[model samples]
Target: LQQVQPQGEDVISGNVSLPKVNVRGVVSNLLRQRETKQGPERVGQTDSDVINLVSMLFDFILDDDNLPVPVKALLGRLQIPYLKLAIQDYSFFSRGGHPARKLLNELARAGIGLNEDADHLKKDMVFKKIQSTAQRILTEYEKEAVLFDELLHDFSQFMQTEVRRSQMIEQRTKAAEEGKAKAQLAEKTALETVRQRLDGKTVPEVVVRLLTDGWMGVLKLVFLKYGPESNNWLGAVKTIDHLLLSVAPTEDDAARKKLFNIVPILLKNLRQGLNSVSFNPF
Candidate 1:
């Protein structure tokens, strides 16, 4: 700190000097990030200080009584898993390809009236992602009461399983195209031959493999946590039902047929999960 005794004019205003510290590696990483328009090459699932800082700001905003009613209502339903992921997985938020990041950008655009900082804030990639998620929660599901975290939890698990399965199928097909058809068929036949004499770790691996598509994967998302023991099975079940039923039969033929084939499996899984609390019912 650089300081001097108060002069006559300063004495009247009670002026004082304070030390200033520059933020570079810790936070100004973002300022440089904006200037360069590129995020760091690698990212992981943890950034304690950034996560804590964002959390503190969220709490501060949420607790501010002076905020308008709509702002409060918007923040209330904005809880989602990826909000934290956006902080933890820096590339996902900053590299400009993620939908979650787009959601944040949307929020930046929404902040025009309440604070003057909003105008400048929209340019920061990280800030935009955080804000856009809050905005989407408010606008997208205004008619319903939903916790964004729970929604992400239910959806991400199912989507991850499906996406992973599709990736595996594509890999297998590519291998076969590269002249590995015999190997692929052999592997499948070997697994089939051992169907009755399954090993300990085999069931889970196979379950994951089989649950790669619409029929089984959808079942897991719907009733796995929607049992009677769950806190809000009704709401979770309702959300799943709405998502599934909204797709019209004429719109997508393949999806419609898949949805139809899924109903029976979904019912069986639902009965096993919610009723018996057993992972196996079929």
Candidate 2:
């Protein structure tokens, strides 16, 4: 086909316009993509397709190409919402796994704004900036509503997964702790019963000697009292105190004499009570 050049300032002005070939080509491709369904055939889409159909249009409006390299670079930073939307759409429709991630990453790199120094700054500034930008977008660009909705849907899905994972991890950790606690309590109760049976003999003293006293004994007593129905908080406190007293800095001689006297009396009383027991004989 023959092309007619649009009349403008004379060619002598040394200015000429290109055929707009790239722009027109891109627009046609965009229309075609809209009509196409997700399938193996569409997997061959190129980087230029994404850039031309989306990023280039935004660039054309913003006159971004005329900006300094650093400024243009800043403008091209990734918008997470947009990238996530594109990723989710491609993943769901096209079943493009690694390719989708790569394409999304490239598009994100090309058209997103940045959060420079966000780590160093206070949160209020960041929050206010986001709110102001969103408000501006709402007022200025009603046509972009579909894009915003898609982005929000992607975010909602992400948050739902995040919440579920956190709940699952919390539940598993709680269950593990409860299991450990139950096992410890059972062991303590068994030990306490053995101590009670040998109370009048040297066995209780031997076990108490083995314990280092302080928090360990406190924990033991707490388990004994709170772990079983027969146990009470008061009993826990008394047990802790008794174990502590045995290891306290009091005069050693006085303490030993008291313990010795108490043990013998307890033993004698227990033996006499046993002797007085009546048995039925035929």
- The lDDT values for all models are 0.42, 0.40
Residue 189 C-alpha lDDT in model 2:
59
Per-residue lDDT value at 36 in model 1: 70
For model 1, the superposed segments whose C-alpha errors exceed 4 Å read: 1-45, 56-67, 92-99, 111-282
Instruction: Give the per-residue lDDT of model 1 (tens digit) for 10-84.
Output: 222224222112322324444355457665433333454545544554555556655433333344334333333
lDDT of 2: 0.40
The weakest ten consecutive residues by lDDT in model 2 span 5-14
Query: Candidate 2 residues 101-220, lDDT tens each?
Result: 333333333323433233322232322333333333333432233544443445445546655876898999999998788868756754664456345544345345433222234434
Clashes of each: 5, 3
